[model samples]
Target chain A: MEELTSIHNQHVKDWKKLSTKKFRKQTGYYLLDGWHLVNEAVHAGVAIHQLIGTADQLDEHRELFDDAKAVYAVTPEIMKHITDTVTPQGIAAVVDLPDAHRVPTQPLTGAWLFLDRVQDPGNVGTMVRTADAAGFTGVVVGHRSADLFGPKVVRSMQGSQFHLQLFEGDLTKWIADFKENGAPVYGTQLNPQAKNFRDVHPGKTFALIMGNEGQGMSQELLTATSDNLYIPMRGEAESLNVAISAGILMFQLNQ
Target chain B: MEELTSIHNQHVKDWKKLSTKKFRKQTGYYLLDGWHLVNEAVHAGVAIHQLIGTADQLDEHRELFDDAKAVYAVTPEIMKHITDTVTPQGIAAVVDLPDAHRVPTQPLTGAWLFLDRVQDPGNVGTMVRTADAAGFTGVVVGHRSADLFGPKVVRSMQGSQFHLQLFEGDLTKWIADFKENGAPVYGTQLNPQAKNFRDVHPGKTFALIMGNEGQGMSQELLTATSDNLYIPMRGEAESLNVAISAGILMFQLNQ
Candidate 1:
């Protein structure tokens, strides 16, 4: 394997560029840094374009190299240049982005999570992880939401991405697709007419829409839903954290 | 306001030492960094010993900080040295540790959250924030748990700590006290015999015990509880993130 030593090296420069949304969009790939995330990516059968690490780091994960298309050795400085973590873990990989093809309009089962403009990567990642744990079929990342494949989201999800299918497109179209199949759509709101989350039935296929950290679901999206549900809070605190509220609502809907 | 320009400044050195647990214990104060967190400490009545920042930084928040006990002007370099964030918000405060006596022995009303060995500061802080929103009377931190006043915990909790009473003590003793008050204790566990969280009748007065991130509640603690509840999951994931799980269970119980 060839070694990458300099910060200005072509490979290092290319890897650094992957951090931008435009680069990721053009290349259809994203970088996964740190040993844990790289290992999880490999375990999930994610196709790797390349694996780069220091000699010592590579020695530790030789088993991961068995199926890699290409492997290269790189120095600590080079790893830091390509990675976003405060302390680079001496290992990184470029994995193919999963195709976000729309699922069939029919035969959908279980609940789904719809995220609308939730910009925080950590919150987006936690919601995906929670959705997967609650048996949601897929996560639909709506307009202005954080990139599902971003480094921060990847770390926060803790490998739940592999278990769930992620869609990045029109939430309205997706909702219409599900509605045609008889799936109940629930939008979270603070309205008096909204039913309590627990009071709703969980036996049927459904989708729960979670909005941005500040502003919630858009009026157009909220009106599109079959029912509006609110999680009752007894305290004077204004609202629960978006991720925590989503988790609570998801679990309640599942149960 | 005194300007601290050098790393060797006695006060700067002392504040930097707070990175170590020993120094924090010795000084009877912990560091709170970032504008958001410093504001939270002030709002929580956590007793800010010193508000340290650059002139420009302090200027931005001057109106919100008229009552700060002591304000110290520092250079950017000095501010960076005393903070953990990559980009210091130019403000960090030293807050006196809350006396354990202040934590209410008896909750005025509603449920309480008992956290045991929750090592992740982020999870611990998120739990506190959630508890505040869920209308939990107070939060009890048990053995091996993250420090309630730690920087990371304080940041994640936002400003919820100010509104809720916090206790750090033996779990066994707290459980006994709850029992003496006739408040039912609900412990989260995976036992098949445990009732589903949604199925349990949420009484006005109860304490919900959330355990470590990796391990659920201890066997002894589980045995002491009046009821064991499990958040039902239908997917292949091992368990929900500890903080997310706590939020789910707490919301359900409060409802």
Candidate 2:
């Protein structure tokens, strides 16, 4: 492992760019922080471009060296310089973007999720993680939603992206595609006339659309959905958190 | 109404202490930020102890002053000093903690949620909001859980706390009480032998226990439930986020 200590080092400056969405998109890579996420990336066989860590961290987790393209031991200050969080974890990795696009898994034969402009990075990541947990085929991150590769979204995804497929596209297009293919496409909203979520039974193929945290799915997309359902608010809360709503729907609708 | 300019003012100093659990408990108060939450608190009838805001904030939100105990217009710097976030919303309130104790809404009726040591402030708050939305009787935060009065938790609860009942105590005791009363208490975990949550139809009344983010419910508490249910994961992620799991169970079990 190469040891680097200067905060102004070119490598350090380049790595820091991973924290921004623009840089991530330009470079086709993102930063993975913390041991668990990095380990998950390693397990999922993500191409690790660089593994940067403090001396102690590298010393304890020597096995990480076996899978990465390169490993570097850096001073704490240098490590901190390359990360955005107030407290930087000791180890992180720069990973090449994997092939994230997925659709018609087995040609329209599995559950999928479409997030419509869910602006919050945390919510976007949670929906992806939940979709992965529910055995969904993939998640379509709608245009205008939080950047799927943004640092916050990456952290919240908890490396689940490596486990399943993720795609960025227009939610309405995905809804249309599913509907055209004869698969059920359910758009979640607060429509009073929509059927209750409990009454819906999903078969093997479906696309569940969860809308924005504030302004829900675009009006056009909702109208295009094969059906719509609302989770009844039995209590006084105005609505369930968006990510939670997505999870409940994914699990309940998963046959 | 009083206008205060200095962050060093005693009143300002006292209000700043609200971010901590100890100070919040000792003063029987906590800070509420953003217009939506403060407005929700007002609508829910929670007694407002002090309203603090920048002059413009006060001007724009005059209605918040109508019933508050006292109102003060402070500098933007003072608003920043009194809040936890780097960018303060410019308006906030010091509110007396409302009575949060609850057991049976009508004695032996209504679904109740018990959170067993769920430590994330966001998770704690989301469960409260979900409990309110699901129309659960109330929520019981067990020992070792996140502070109910913490700022993050309060923000996430979003005034739902005022709409429904919330109590803090031991999970074991609450489980015993609900079981003794004959309302089926369902503890959610990933135990393979546990019945699926979907199979258990929550009637007019029952108790649903959600475990902590990392540990799930304590062993003793799980054993004391009327039954245990699992949200079967059809996908590969190890587990669902705690708040998402709580929301799913709350809606599934809410008759």
TM score of chain A per candidate:
0.94, 0.94
Which candidate gets the maximum lDDT versus the true structure?
2
Index of the highest-TM-score prediction:
2
DockQ, candidate no. 2: 0.80
Off by over 4 Å in 1: A1-8, A34-44, A53-63, A76-81, A86-92, A101-109, A190-194, B1-97, B101-110, B179-184, B189-196, B215-229
Candidate lDDT (C-alpha), each: 0.83, 0.84
TM-score of 2: 0.93
Global local distance difference test of model 1: 0.83
> Could you tell me the interface RMSD of model 1?
1.3
* Candidate 1 per-residue C-alpha lDDT over A1-255 given as tens digits, one digit per residue, 9 for 90 to 100: 787788888878889998887888888888888877787787788888899898999998898788678898998878877886778888888988666655644577778899999999999988988988888877889889998888788877777788877888888988887789888889998664788887888565888999988888899999899888887766656677889989988887876
Candidate 1 clashing pairs? none
Candidate 2 lDDT by residue in tens digits, B1-255: 999998889999988888887887788788898887888888878888899889998999787788799999999998888887788889898888654554434455687888888889999999899889888877888888898888889889988878877788877877777778778999988776899887888678788888878788888988899889987776668888989888888877785
lDDT of model 1 at residue A197? 84
How close to the true structure is residue A48 of candidate 2, measured as C-alpha lDDT?
A: 84
> Which of the numbered candidates is closest to the native, going by highest DockQ?
2
